[model samples]
Target chain A: MIGLYLTAPYLVYLVIVYAVPIIQGFRISVLDYVYAAPGASVPQPFVGLKNYRKALSDPLLRRSFLNILEFLAINVPLTVILGMTLAAVLAKLSRMKTFFRSAFFVPYVTASIAVIGVWYFLFSQGGLIDHVLGSWAPNPSWLVNSKLAMVVIALEVTWKQLGFYVLLYLAGVLLIPDSLYEAASIDGAGPVRQFRAITVPALRNITILVTTLALIVGANLFAEPYLLTGGGGPNGATMSPALLIYQKGVEQGEPGVGAAIGVLLTLFILLVAGAGAGARRLVQAREAA
Target chain B: MRNGQYGRTLRRLTTYGFVTLGALASIFPLYYMVVGSLQLRADSAFSGLIPKAGNLGLQNYRDVNKAISLLPSLGNSAIFTLGTVVLTIVVGLPAGYALARLRFPGKPAVAGGLILVLVLPFQVMMIPLYILAVRDYGLADNYLGMILPFAVNPAAVLIFRQFFISLPDELFDAAHIDGAGEVRTLLLVAAPLTKPAILTASVITFIGPWNEFLWPFLITKKHSMQPLAVSLGEYVSTNAATAANPYGVILAGACVLAVPVIALFLVAQRYFTSAALGSGVKE
Candidate 1:
């Protein structure tokens, strides 16, 4: 009972913040939450999945979803591989370990919104990156190139976030006992062999954790695309679901449709998380077998 | 032995070389943002990569300060971000302690509910939250509205719970013997020892709203109340033509906004890394 008393504040907050809004989110999804003029009462009539049906057929919405798919197709593998590789190498270092760790982490620690402007400046016409690429630079530039725009967004996301996953993997890598590696070397195993046989197997749970984190991040991406692409520019080539939600719900004054997108995005995230958990279990069970 | 020594030297050099390259890539944009902020407008594109020392000036910084009401917007971000950090810790600490230390019914239900909530994205709840606060409460144009939804942070709650659980049971038992209740025990015994959790929670929570664009942008359209990130965002997207050098002016504001966050990280980074390890939560 004392525990209940102590936890009362959170319970109340949970209802007001999470539970009520979540329920209201579902409610708004099914109703036409037409924007009313101030001090005017508007009755929201039930639309019965009209918003969802519209969402299914909406090309821009469809484009947004496809954009994110292409985004993760580039982002996920790059983040995981680079993160693991950096962590593995850093774990073996004795000199300037602190310096390397802090230096790598600075970008992740800095706000993406703050540094995204720098990416814009760099990638703009005849900017640092364009100047560096010389004649090989895309004619309209990378940020504006419909073909290469999403790739730039993904790479920007990777550059800003690689440190975070590196730190996570580094933590996991450190927990593998030095004895395992020493034993591997006694059998004349090289560093690559030791890493594969010893480090990889020991860090399975963290790897799963890292992959799920990367996936969740991929699913919810907003700030970079919003800023870097200047609000999904050059024909919505860089649009993300979060930006779409903002446009429909807040900007476009169609809360019902926005809520529908929100509902779909949430469902997608839940499904991905569930699938990730299942994969981890399957891997664990296989090891047990 | 000489061959072995040479091979080991080569391997170590390879490791250092790889890490340094990654670190340089990581840090360059920030360095460029600050350096570029100082470069004269005419110097851009012509001298983009290696900044000339003599040509750099504080003109862009001054221009940005004037361009977006940088000082006032900075104050708004400070208030908004600080308000969020304080409320998150205050509300999260007690709930986390109760979950970890106190015996209660429905504990499993609460835990599971927390997990369900964890998987939830803020984008999912953002609509109704906007409705609830902006429509129902009429808190549009208010910092409190911008701060509230994020205040009851699930990550902070989880971080605190995980931190409290790791504390030995003996501390709580002694507090109990001294006639301290659960809340009192947390206040006197646990809060002091949980600096790491507090710092980690503050770091993550502070970054989200301090740097968030959408919520504050939705809540308050008033220039005085808009956070620096939103103002800078508007500048980035729409208002670039107002400045002499749009690139430098925009980056100047970004640099100002980033200074405090990066400074805090530099000062307390060990707490950040160790705390993330301890809590299993991300910013």
Candidate 2:
């Protein structure tokens, strides 16, 4: 069929770029993984999950997982709370909606590399934020402080990404009927009460969506750590699994080890994202009731 | 009535106060970035929240030009973005059209494959793809090497297919009944309807690679071959970290890397509405 001809390019593209590589990734993960150039006389003997065992016990890789855990602890709540609250406010504004929307949204469109520079400037020692904080700032700067560096990265991710999530929340908020708010108001409920009972409950599904989306993105925290922390620095406090993959696999040319990290990270993402998807369906079913 | 009036005023004030503060928080960094780029300062920090006309100049930009060579990198970014976007649309549009309208035998299989790959993060394939680009394919430091992995986007195909499928079946049926060939129908009839999808796909695709750093950074060992983001990324990690951190130069590079996407956002923002962003996130 003409259909087969038409669709072949993408299928072929996916095969070469995604499927085969996934297979290759699994193969490499189980091998000893030569660091040699193409066609070099090196034997990559089957290691049979030796790399996986090493990756699990590897300090930086283990730290990378905990690093994301800390990142998620800061990023998820901040993103959801800030996003929906901003959305709630935006919903109330009858004027300058477009202006406010675009204001929040510009950073989302800007390159992380570009704005990570601003983040660097803002959080650098004696910079605007530090000057504003005025002696409350951490010693050795936020960039160099082991404890604060990950926190800064989390905030940067939340700030750059919060706008898009706010828009998502805004769309969800706009769908809840005005009549519910009206009824709540008539029942002697103030704005806060109405939001608590009507708005929050109505947007429950969106909150799940927003939270999981944030979780999925945060798990693969790469550029923010890579660029902002200069490839996960300050004693590996900012090291992420994704960055570790680049370092071990690409930069260090230890494909087997990197592939092991990659496979584990992939499994972690799939499990969490899968659970999120399942939760979404459960929420939908409950709402449909 | 007076109590109600007081409450109303308080609520409005709080609403305005929250939104104003949030908006300022969101947008000020960019305004400051532009300000930071233009200023000449010894320490290379932000001069202040506001730019003083007396302190500002093109000196940092000049330094950026000398340091990173902005023009060639911009050209490289443009070429990389164009290659990926054009190739994606070329490959994806036809495939989408076929899957949506034509009776392909593997249509179900393709759809299943898409669902399977929907949540397939690029991180999963980064290693092997890097190997393919660098060692196996010998594409290291090459333009095609930098662009090849991103050339075909599954999300773009999915978006195009969904958009095409949304159109009425009667329309495609009529074109087929007219004996117009599939290609002709796509160009003349179906293609016109796909403008929104095309625009959405193109813009979304543009931003992803336009702002990308890591992959290209991996592909190119040479500074000259690196795109704008990679060059700036390399700079910030190295030169920008030293005691001689060039604040103006860094922001100047950031400005070059940032301005195009921001400009595109401003010009075509209507297409970047919540609906499109929702779909675009699949990228």
Candidate 3:
């Protein structure tokens, strides 16, 4: 009793700070509410799945979902490949390993606003990229063009995240015993062949881990496109589900709809995360067996 | 054998070249940001990798300061980030210790729940949490509003727990024989051994709060309450015209925001590298 009392402040803090918001969030999803008309009335008629249906059927919402799917499809593989290659190379360096690692990871630590700012300049018309390209051809506004806008945003996310993936891959690669490489070398297996046969296979689990985590995060894309294209510019070309919820809830003052989108997004993320965890466990189990 | 050695040297050279090139590509934008930030507004059009002498000036910093309260926003960020780090470490350490060391009931359930929390995306809860913060808690537009939601990151807890679990049981047995209670044991004996994990957790939590944009942007509307990220966003948005978009000032802000974490990581670079690698491996 004394121990519980002593720790009561911490427990209360967690319950109030962490748990209540989640519970309240769910409750608000069921209740039809608007932020604009505060203190309008209580018992604000529960509108069971109406908000969810609206969120699901809305064309803007559907487009946002499609945009996220497109982002995942394009960015995931590129990040994984780039990260693995960099990690593999870095792992071999006998000197300057720390410098290279820090350099790569620097972008990950920098503010997203700063990253977007730099990228905006790079991708803008008559900016760095355009300046380089204009010597050969006419320049187009990267952010204005819908297709190009998506690509630019994807590139920004990849830049920020690739370092993290490199770190993960380095960890995965370092775990493989050097004896395997030595044995492969003794067998006259060249570097490329050894990497393909041993390194790739050994890194299978980490690859899956990275891919699944990236997929989950990629689907929640918000800040890059939001900053780049000004929150789904030029006919909502790059809007994600997360941004859609923000728009509905904050911008449009429709809390219920926003909450509904939040619930759906949560469900989608959970489903993917659960599948990934299960798959990882199965792989581990099989390997152990 | 000579041909084989030549081929091996060629492969090594290619690997080194590729790695260097990749690092350069990764670091270039950041380099551009820094170089551009030092340039005068008129010279913002310079497309080169380096900033020239005349163009390199502190005018952008002056303009940024005059235009936006960059310092205050930085202070707000520090306050929020520091608060988050302290709260997370304090709350997380004990819970993590208990879950790791104690033969408590429902141990697996607690551990599993923490892992699930780690993988769960905060985007899903953003709207609902915002409403709750505003309505129920009255935390909207307040410092606590931003700090509280992030006070207990499950990832930090999990990492701490994992580190604690790896400690030898003999330490706890010795502490018990010395008549030290669990709390004392954690604070005195266990914690000293878990510094690496604690530092790693602190670094991660600090970075998350420091660079966080969406939550702060959503929760806080007042300019004074905004962090550096939110302020920078507003600065770019509002001053898109008449300001020449001082890349130098923006980069200065970026550097200001980035330097502390970068330095912390550099100081603890070994721990960070190990933690980054270690966390990916299975228990």
Top-DockQ structure, candidate number: 1
Give DockQ per model, in order.
0.66, 0.65, 0.50
> Candidate 3: where are CA atoms >4 Å away?
A1-14, A36-43, A135-139, A270-289, B42-47, B246-249, B276-283
| Clashing residue pairs for model 1 | none
Tell me the tens digit of each residue's lDDT in model 3 across B55-132.
677777777777777789889999999999988888787777777777655556555656655666677778767877
Clashing pairs in 2: none
Q: After superposition, how far is residue A215 of candidate 3 from its true place, in Å?
A: 2.3
Per-model interface RMSD values are 1.9, 2.1, 3.0
TM-score of chain B of each: 0.92, 0.89, 0.91
Q: Model 2 RMSD to the real structure?
A: 2.9
Please list the residue runs of candidate 1 whose C-alpha ends up more than 4 Å from where it truly belongs after superposition: A37-39, A272-289, B42-47, B275-278
Q: Which window of ten consecutive residues has the lowest lDDT sum in model 1 chain A?
A: A210-219
| Best of the candidates, lDDT | 2
Per-residue alpha-carbon lDDT of candidate 2 for residues B127-226, written as tens digits (9 for 90 to 100)? 8888877778789898889888788666788778878878998887898899999888889999888889988888878888899987898788899899
Tens digits of lDDT, candidate 2, A21-107: 899999999998776777787888998989999888889988987887788889888887888889999999989999999999999
* Deviation of model 3 at B49, angstroms: 2.3
